[model samples]
Target chain A: MNKQSLVYTVIFTFIVSFVFVTLLALANDGTKERVQLNQELNRQRAILNALNIDYNGPQDVQDKFQNVEQIERDGVTLYRTTVDGETIYAKEFTGSGLWGLIRGYLAVTANMDRTIGIEILSHNETPGLGGRIDEPWFKQQLRNEKIVDGTIRVDGAGDGDTNHDNGQIDAITGASRTSDAMRTILSRELSTFQQILGGNS
Target chain B: MSSPGQILKENLWTNNPIFMQVLGICSALAVTNLLTNTMIMTIGVTFVTAMSNLTVSLLKGLIPRKVRMIVQTLIIAFYVIIVDILLRAYLPDISRALGPYVGLIITNCIIMGRAEAFAQSNPPLISMWDGATSGFGYMAVLLVIAFFRELLGFGTLFGIQVLPDAFVPWTIMVTAPSAFFFLGIIIWIGKSIMNREGAPA
Candidate 1:
C-alpha cells in the first residue's frame, strides 16, 4: 500500500494488460479467416441438405445453390436450390419441440408431393431426449417420404405396400415428442406452401 | 529448459481444466455429442484461451486491481464477439450448428479462470503456453467423450463412414447425458493419473 509499492503494482498491471490485449488482437487476426469460411460453407451445406441437392464439388454445389432462389410463400420462407434449370428441391420450414425451439426444413420434390430429404437447421432442447432430432437416422426417415393424402407415414407402413403417395417417415425411438414436433412443423409449412402456390397460380 | 515431454505430461494428464478443475463444463457437455463439432469447438476455445491469457498476462501490471476483473471480462467478451461474427460470416454452417454454444463460450468458466489464475501472474510467453496447454487439456477430455459419442452414437468419425452398415448405433451415446457420463469418467482417469504421478492429489 506504500507509494512505491502502489506504483510498482500499477506499472506491472498496466504492462500486463496492454500486452495481453495486444497479443489477443494479433492472434485474432491470424485465425479469423479460416473460421469464418468454415462456418459459411457449413451453412450452405445445411441449406443444400435441406434442399436435398447433392453435389460432387464445392464449385458444383455453389453453382447449384446459386440457381436456387429463396422465396417467401405466405409466412414460411422456402429455400429453393436448383440444378440444371429444374426445381430440384424446395425447403419448407417450421419450428417446435420440447423445452426449446426446433427449426426443420422439409426438402420436397419439384412437384411438392414427395420429400427428397430433410434437415434440422437449429434446435435447443433437452440434450439426450429432444435433441436427437438432428440424428441422420431420424433425418433419413424423411427421405423419399411422400406428402400425399394429408397424412405422413414412416417405414412405408399402413398403406398395404401400395400407398406410394402417402407421406411417411420412421420416427426415432424415445424421441416421440420431437418426431411429432417435426411432423407438425413440416405439415404446417407444407400446407402454407400449398396455399401460397395456389395463390401465385 | 523444461522438456517438451514434461509439457505434454502436464497438459494431457495433470492440471487438466476439465478433468481436474472441471472448468468449461457447459460447452464440454454440449459439443461433445459430435466429434467434428467437438474438435471445432475445442480449437476455438484453445485459440481464445491462449490468446486471452497472453493478453491478460501482458496487461497484468497496468490494470487497476479493483477493475481488473471487469477488464478481463471486457477483453473476453470482445474476443468472443469477434469469434461469433467470424463464425456467422465464414463458418455459417458450424456457426449455425454450434448455435448458442459458441456465444456461451464467453461464459465458459475455464477461459475466465485461466485469465485470472494463471495469466494474471505469469509472463506473457509462459502464459500463452499455459493457456494453450490447458485448452488442450480441456479439449482432450471432451474429444475423448466426443469420440465415443460419434462412434457409438452415430457409428462415424468426423461424419465419415466408419462402422459397417451392419453396425447399429447405441443411440444413447450421441446425447448430452452421455457427455456428462464420459466427462465424469475422464475426470476420474485424469485425477488418478495425476495422483499416481505424485502431483498433489
Candidate 2:
C-alpha cells in the first residue's frame, strides 16, 4: 500500500503501461486497413499526375488507373497508358536526396525521348529548400523536356541560361545538392528504363 | 488553489506556452509554413498533451518520485503514437504532409513541462484542462505566423488562392527563417500588449 515501496512502483508502472499499450494496439488495428488504402491511393494518384491526367477523388483515380497497364520488366514496374492511340510509360523512382530518400513517378512519351511529366510522391528533403522540388514551378521544368543522349542536364539557379530546351532545369536556390541528385537520378533511371524498353531511346 | 477557468486563462494568455512561456518552438517553426499543417499539428499536440496530462495526474498519487519522469515520458509517447496511427488511418493526406513532425511530438517540451510542473500536483481534470489550454495557446501563435507565411509566401490561405493574380509571392516567407522573424515579431507585440495592461513583460 506504500506509494514509495518498490512493489507498488512496479505494479503502478506495469498497470499504466499495460493500459496505454492496449489502447495504442486497438487504435493501430482499427486504422491499419484504411492507412494501407490511403497509401495505395496516393501511389495511384502520383502515377496519374505523372501522366498529366486530371483526377478528382479516389473513384477518379481508380477509373483513370484502369486504363493504365502494369508491366514489370527487369525489376522495374512500368505503368503504360494509352490515349488516342498514343502510349505513355511511367516508372517509380527512388533516389538519395540531400537529407534522405526522394521518391516519385517519372512518365515519358511513347518515343521515350520527351518526358510527359513528373510527380513527386514522397520525399524527406529539407522543407522550403530541397523540398521545393515538389513545387509546381520546379517540377514543371522537367515536363516535356527532351532527354538528350540518355542524360538530363540541370543548371544551377542564376546561371547564364534557365532554359529547358537543352534538357537543363534550374536548381532550387538553396538546394544545389538535391537538384544535382535529382538530375543524376533521372538520367540513371531513364537509361535503365530505356534498356527495359528494348533500347528505344 | 486556482479555479479551472483561471488555469485556462493563465495557460492560454498570461503564461502562454509559445508566446509568453516560449516552451515549445521547434514544431511551431517547422510546420507553420502552411495553415493546414499548423492546424493538424496543433490538434495532435493538444490530444497528446491533454491525454498524457490526465493520465499522469490520475497516477500522481501512486507514482514513485524516482521514476516519475520516465513514467511521464512513456505516457506522453503512448498518446503520441496513438495520434500518429489515427492520422495515418483517417487523414492520410495530412499525415503524409506532416511527415515525422507528428512522431517528434514526443519530444515537444510543452507536454513534458506541464506533466512535471502542473500534472504532478494537480487533479486529473485540472491537469487535462491546463495541458489542452497550453496547446491551444501554442496553436494560436503558430496560426498567426502561418497566416502571414502562407499568404505572402505562397499567395494562398489554407491552400486557397486568396491573393489577386497581380500579387507576387515572397519566396523567403516560405522558408524556415521567415517563421523565426514572424514568431519574434509576434512575441514582441504580445509582450508589449501585456506590459501596457500592467502585467510583467
Candidate 3:
C-alpha cells in the first residue's frame, strides 16, 4: 500500500476516478431530461427570435411557442408561426465555421424571397472575431434582407455590392471565414427552405 | 491548522484568490457585465470549490502522488458538471447567458490551487471552508465590478432601473474593455491596502 508505488498509483488513480466519475454520472442522469428540455427551449427561443416574436422569459417562451406548429415536409422540419396574419417559416441550419460547426435557425417569408431573421443557436468561432456573429448588430443585419434561391451573400461591405437592399449582407470585419461560412449555411438552407415551403404550400 | 475565522478573513480579503493570488480573472471579466449573472456564476463557483476541496482533502491520503493532478481535475470537473446541469434545469436563461463559462469553471485555477495548497494538507471541513471563502473572495470583487458595469453600462442595478432619466448609459461599459479598468482599479486598491498593512506574511 506504498503511496509511491506504481501499482498503488494505478489502483489509487482508478479508485479516485471511479468515485468522482460515479457522482458526476449520477448527477448527469438525474438532470438529463431537464437539461434536454432547456436545450429544446433554447431552440424554441431561437425560432421565436427569427420570427420576431417577443417573449419576456422562459414561461413566455413556452407560452409564445405554443402558437408555433412543427411541420415536416420532405424531411425538412419547419417551425411555423403566424404573426399578424403573415406566415413565417423557420428551419434549423448548420454549416462549418472557421473553428467548428455553426448551427442556427433561419426564418423566412412564405414566398422565401426575404429573410424574416436569423438566430445563431450555437457556434465555436473565436470570441470577439467570428464570435461577433452572435452580436445583436450582426444578426440584426440579417433581418428582412432580400434573398432569391438563398443567393444571399455575406461579403465585405463594398467587395461586390455594399447595398443591403440587395441580397448582400455585410460580413463581420476580421471574420471572413466565419462570414463565408454563414453565407454557405444560409444560401444552402434558404434554397432548401424555399423548396420546403414551396412544396407544402 | 488555521482557525475558521482566519481562513474566512484570508480568503475573503487578505489572501483572496482573485485579489491576493490573482486567480480566476478570466471569469471575473467575462461574467461581471450583469450583476445577476455574476451572482449566479460566482455562487456556482463557490459551491464547486467547496465540494471539490472537501473531496480532495478527504481523499488526499489515499491519492497516489504521481496521479494527484488528474484526480484533483476529475474531482473539480465532477462538481462543475453538476453545477452546470443544475443551472440548465433551473435557471436556463442565465445558464444560456453564462454559456461555456460554466463548463470553463473546470479550468479555473482557484479550484485546483486550493485543492493542492490548502485541501491536500488541511482537514476536510477546514479545506471546504477555505475553498468556500476563497470563492466568496472572488465573488466579492466580481460583484463590485459587476455592480459598476451594470449600473453605468445599462443604468440599471441587477437589471432594475437605478439611474435617473438624465442618465445616459456608457456604451463602452458593457463591452469587454470596461472590465479591464474596473479590475485594474480593484487590484490597485487591494494591493495598496495590503502594502499599508506593512508586510506580506
Candidate 4:
C-alpha cells in the first residue's frame, strides 16, 4: 500500500473504532447507576451476612439498614455504619494471600472488641479451596468471637471447644493458607478499627 | 456447499475449544467450582465473543491490513466492557464471584483468536455464529469439568447433594489446579475419539 493510502486506512480505522467504542460507552451510561446501586447493595448484604443479619432483596435491605453514616479519618473513609438498634461498622482490610490479594470486611460490635462477623468482599485464591472461604459455613464461625484474642488456627480436629486464651474459629479444611491469611488480615484490621473507634467508645 | 449440520457438528463437538483447542482455560479454571458461576461466566463469554466477532467482521473490509489486529483488539475490548458493566448491574453476586476475571476477558485468547482467525475473514453473520458456537463448545467442556468438580468437591451439584452419606467428598476437585487436570483428561479423551475417526488435521 502507498503511504497516502496507508494513512487513509489508519485514519478510517481509528475513526470507526473510536466511534464504535464511544457508542458502547454511551449505551452503558444508562445502566451505570443501576450497576453502582447493585454493587452498594451487594456490599451491604455481604456485611450484613457477616453480622448474621439477613434480608431478602433491595427493599428488604433498605428496610433493615435504614441508617448509614460514614466514619472518616484524615479525609479517608475508615468505616461505615448502618444503624438498626445496634450500630454495625464495616471496616475494610487487604492482605497478601497464598495466590493473590484477600480483601474483606470485618464488622465489629459496638464495643469494638467483639466481632459481629466477617465477610470476604474479594479474593484471588484457588477456587474450591481458598474460595470456600466465601461459604457461610466458614464465615458463621466468626460470629460472637472476641476480636481482642480471636486467633484463627489449623490444628488436629478437636471437639468444638472454646479456649478463651485466644478467640478460636474452626478453620476451613484444606484451605489452611487462605484461612491463615484471613486471620492475619482480620487481626490487623481489628486493631486499626480499635484505634478509630477508641475515642467514641 | 457444507450443510449447517456439518458446521454445527464441527463447532459444537468435533473441534470444541475447551475440550479440543483448550482456549479460554483461565475462566474454566477459575469459575467452575460452583455451577452458578460457571453458568454466568459462560453467558458473559458468549456475549463478548459473539459481539466482538460481529463487530470485527463488519469492519474487516474497512480495516487497514497493517493495523487489523489492533482494530480487532479495540472491538473485542469494547464488547468485554459492555458485558462487564451489564453483569455488575444485573448479577452483582456472580460479578463479585468473577472478580477481575470478568474484565480479564478482554485478554481471553478465545475472543482474540476467533477475531484474527475466523471473524476477520468471514461475514459478520457467520462470524457471530462462529463466536457463539465456539462459546457453547467452551461451555460444554467447562460444564463437564464443573459437574465433577461440584460433585466430588462439595458432595453436590448446583448445591444439591447427589452423594449418599457414605461417599466422602474429594477436596482437590474444586480448586483451580484440578481444572487443569480435568481439562487434560477431557482433551485426552477428545483426542482419542478424534484419532479413532482418522485424525483429521
TM-score, each model?
0.75, 0.92, 0.78, 0.83
Question: Candidate 3 lDDT, tens digit per residue, B15-54?
Answer: 8888788899889888888899999999999999999999
Q: Compute fnat per model.
A: 0.12, 0.76, 0.76, 0.64
- For DockQ, candidate 2 versus 4, the one ahead is 2
lDDT of 2 by residue, A35-150 (tens): 88999999999999998889888999999999989998787789998866778899999999988889999998767777778899888887667888888888888777887887
For residues A1-201, write the lDDT of model 3, one tens digit per residue. Answer: 578999888877787678777877888898889888888888889999998899997899999999999988798788988888888899888899999989989898897778888899888886556777887878877788888445787767422343447887778766788888888888788778866777655
**Cα shift from native, residue A46, model 3 (Å):** 2.4
For residue A103, model 1's alpha carbon misses the true position, in angstroms, by 3.1
Over B1-201, each residue of candidate 1 has an lDDT whose tens digit, in order, gives 445467556666765787767778888878887787888788888888888888789877766777678778767776776677677656666776787888888898988998998789878887788778878888888888889898888788998979998897785686667788888887787678777878796
Error of 1 at B5 (Å): 7.1
Residue pairs in collision within model 3: none
| Ten contiguous residues minimizing lDDT sum, candidate 3 chain B | B168-177
Candidate 3, residue A82: how far the Cα is off, in Å: 4.4
The C-alpha local distance difference test score for the whole of candidate 2 amounts to 0.87
DockQ of each: 0.21, 0.69, 0.43, 0.57
Give residue B169's lDDT in candidate 4 (0 to 100).
69
Please provide, for model 2 over B19-136, each residue's C-alpha lDDT reduced to its tens digit, 9 standing for 90 to 100: 8878888998899989999999998999899999999999888789978999999999998998899889888989989988999999999999999999999999989998898888
Docking class of 3: acceptable
Q: Which lDDT value does model 1 have at A117?
A: 71
Model 2 - which docking category? medium
